[model samples]
Target: MALAYFNGNIVDMDDPVIPIEERGHQFGDGVYEVIRFYQGKPFMMREHLERLYTSAKAIRLEIGKQQNELETLMLELAAKSGLENADLYMQATRGVAPRNHLFPKCPASISITVKPSRELPQDVRKQGVQVVLLPDERWQNCYIKSLNLLPNILAKQEAFEQGCFEAVLVRDGFIMEGSSTNMFIVKDGKVQTTPLSNYILAGITRLAVKRIAEELQVPFVEKPFTPEELLQADEVFLTSTTSEVLAVTSADGRQIGSGCPGPVTRKLYEHFQLKVK
Candidate 1:
């Protein structure tokens, strides 16, 4: 069963608990995180929480609870849903206030929902997916996972209209990342991805892939690459919390690396499964 939580109450998923003046609803003033649980156990819970707090701080909004307290609430919500494999989405906002542009002096509003995991089809995972390259039009603070996602949503929708899974965002002739995933390419047997910066969100799954690469002794490099380079690479792939490690067999309708999920992506994905287990 799916569940919804607001402040300190577990409410019906469709109930309207947030006021019309809630900052998140009015101005997108919030930070959020989607945590995945397998068999009721969370993966990298600490890292996810840290990033959540970091995003809140970057936006000058307080979550109004200690990290451990939020973690406890999340775990309890996930367990209460009775879903062994679940996705817990949590958000912290600047709270309700009368129509105004300034920050309000009110306790932050926290909401959470837990539902069964949305797993991709096995065929799509095995055969890989296509992506469209779009210009990066997000704010300079892309590193902060804030609620202002208009640009990202637009790009993602554009990709979907084109029969693609994700929008690979490019900035200044270099690939930044996907609209919601980190981009990677394999060249000369080395894993290459964009280095951490304000231009891209540092993905936890990307970090996991780096660790898996090291464990397998595969060379991992962090640097920006152009679309031409991606097309010329030995392989292409992407990573995210939901997507995990997914190969990019086509970009902008161009086939990549024999138009299949490459060997390195398969190996890293196998190790990721092991890590989760």
Candidate 2:
């Protein structure tokens, strides 16, 4: 039996009931954060919370709670879950409202749920995983971690049907990011990724990878790279809260470099693991 925080009350995970007219359900009007815990301690928690607030602000959706209060509630829920490794998922929506395109005047409703953590398959880390390229058809505010994600869902499903682990999204021929992760490329011993922009989500793991690269003396450059360049790179990888650092061995049936997780990716993953610990 796990615990959940809903509308300022702690309740059984399976007991809390969300109203049918909740705006998050009726209109996808919300922002969310997924924080990972290692050894029962949250990693980059401040960063995640900051991003959560940023997303909420971007949507003009108030979280209705102070940052400290939210953090305390999340940690309490994590302790109640009793999972050494788990994910803290919190979402703030515009509250229950009648269906309308206009913004609601009600205060936001917040919910926090804790669940078991997910680790990338050992085979993926050992042999790398395949990805396919898809056109970026999402809305302009990709930076917001809003509940609206139809395009991302469709693209990820398409990639799954094509036997790929993830979908590398392209905008005007340049690779922006993965469906649920940030894309990276290594060429000529230099690592490159898209810069922080409205085109993609600024993933927390992506920031950690950059910091690890800096500490390890890896040349980490932030710039846009085309889909052609991504396919031709010596190595490719993706980063996300759940995926961590994942190597992309092939794209669209084409082998990248030696068709394996290259040395650079391996080194980054190693350092990232140590950082999390």
Candidate 3:
């Protein structure tokens, strides 16, 4: 069985009992980060933690543990789990309390679970995948990685039922992002994606991809593009902590460009591999 760290205690996943009264359970009052590791070294761990703390602060939730302490504990959990290639899912929730809809005096409750990493399907990487357009029905504070994910969950379910890789969310006719990943499109050899705003999560992989684009001398732009623009783009893709860089060959069953992973997407994917290696 995998190992889990709950409130500073490491235990088997099957036995890490969480109390029913935890505020996160009742009200989704929490923030989380998922750290991916390669060859036992976490990739961009500091960036992920920084975002996690930022999310917590935005929600007015106090993460009592210092950054150093959290880092040491995460490394220890990784070592104890003996997972060379894994994903560390960490979450901090407001403490247990009666259902009051208000902050309580209880300390924050932290949990971390270690699981083996699952690579994106090779077929999708090589041939690219299809996505569906969905309405962006999330809250205004998506920039904060809070645990209120009902909207995201519903969108993901819609995508799964449609046999698509992701749901590209649209708001006010402009493409915002995916349910679980960030979206990018290439038009006339220029790369464009939604800018960093409350509309989308500022993804770490998105930053890494931008750097790779710069290193490769690929033209990069960050601005809002409509759903029609996205559909007509020469190429499209999504990025996330787990998915890394993925090409979208089609949306709503319509082919994109030549119906394959475009040159810019391939180039970024290659450079991303080199970066992580």
Please provide TM-scores, in order, for all candidate models, with all chains considered together: 0.99, 0.97, 0.98
Models sorted by lDDT, best on top: 1, 3, 2
Candidate-wise lDDT, in order: 0.93, 0.91, 0.92
Candidate 1, residue 27: lDDT: 95
Give lDDT: candidate 1, residue 32: 93
lDDT of 2 by residue, 1-277 (tens): 3567789888777784888899999989999999999989999999999999999999998888899988888888898889989988899999988888899888899988888898877987999999999999999889999999999999999999999999999998788999999999999999999999998999999999998999888999999999889989999999999989989999999999999899999999988889878
lDDT value for candidate 1? 0.93
* Candidates by TM-score, descending order: 1, 3, 2
Off by over 4 Å in 1: none
- Writing each residue's lDDT as its tens digit, candidate 1 over 70-137 gives 99989988989999998889999999999799999999999999999889899999899999999999
Greater-TM-score candidate between 2 and 3: 3
How do the residues 66-177 of candidate 3 rate in per-residue lDDT, one tens digit apiece? 8889999999888888989999999999988888887899999999999999798798799998999999999999999999999999999999999998999999999999
Candidate RMSDs in Å, in order, are 0.7, 1.2, 1.0
Can you give the lDDT of residue 200 in candidate 2?
94
